[model samples]
Target: MAGLVAALIVGVGLWWSSPVSSGDVHRYVTEAARQQQIALNDGSLVELNVSSDLSVKPTAGERRVTLAAGEAHFAVAHAMARPFIVTAAGVSVLAVGTAFSVRLGETGVEVLVTEGRVEVARDPVDAATSGGGRPKLGVGERTLFYATNP
Candidate 1:
């Protein structure tokens, strides 16, 4: 009985030492001809361009943002244990302590890496499943993603 109790305590301690989970409690939106600067709970900064909409959802071991429209420049805080990911137009961009910009247009999605590195992947399909890793974009690199008509 004492051994079982010890094991339970260790298990709980390990989980507690891990990253704690958080939810999307903050949201920001910009109107036409207007720009806004938002500060997240985790000390990250987001410069929202005109006519942009985004939401921040922090989960266990990861921080997520859903960009519904327009463009934004993000200066993420350094958190190696928790990756920051942005989803726009069915595309995902993962970063850790990076500065980048993402623009969603009617034609396609555009990403610009200003600092650090980021991994980009097309959504709805797991890149890892095909044994192909997601493409990594380094600083000063830019890419455009356009979906093909099936």
Candidate 2:
């Protein structure tokens, strides 16, 4: 009975520490006129701006975040095996270990890299109308992606 109790305690401890390891999806939303900060399971940090909506999912191969609306700054943790990716509108930003901000606006999506580097690309379905190119942005660089109508 003592051995069984010890095993159960260990299991519960592991589960509580890494709930996202079970493929859980975490969502965060910021209220209007307010900002919020979120710490991801992988040690990354995100600062969500006012009226922003963000969803985070950790998969076996990568860490993904979807910005449904508003803006957010990402301070990604370094995990070479799993790349960090952020998607907003039709644009995708890929970063291995970087700090960047993505904003979804009325006319387009804007990406600003404050540290490290990131690869910005348009979704394949919108490639034709948006052009084709994977632009790499370094620290202090910024790019604007025009919104496309489906």
In terms of TM-score, which candidate is strongest? 2
lDDT by residue (tens digit), candidate 2, 74-97: 999998878888999979988888
Q: Give the distance in Å from residue 95's predicted Cα in candidate 1 to where it truly belongs.
A: 0.3
What value of lDDT does candidate 1 attain over all alpha carbons? 0.80
For model 2, the local distance difference test gives 0.82
Poorest 10 consecutive residues by lDDT, candidate 2: 124-133
Model 1 Cα RMSD, 1 decimal: 14.6
- What TM-score would candidate 2 get against the native? 0.78
For residue 37, model 1's alpha carbon misses the true position, in angstroms, by: 0.5
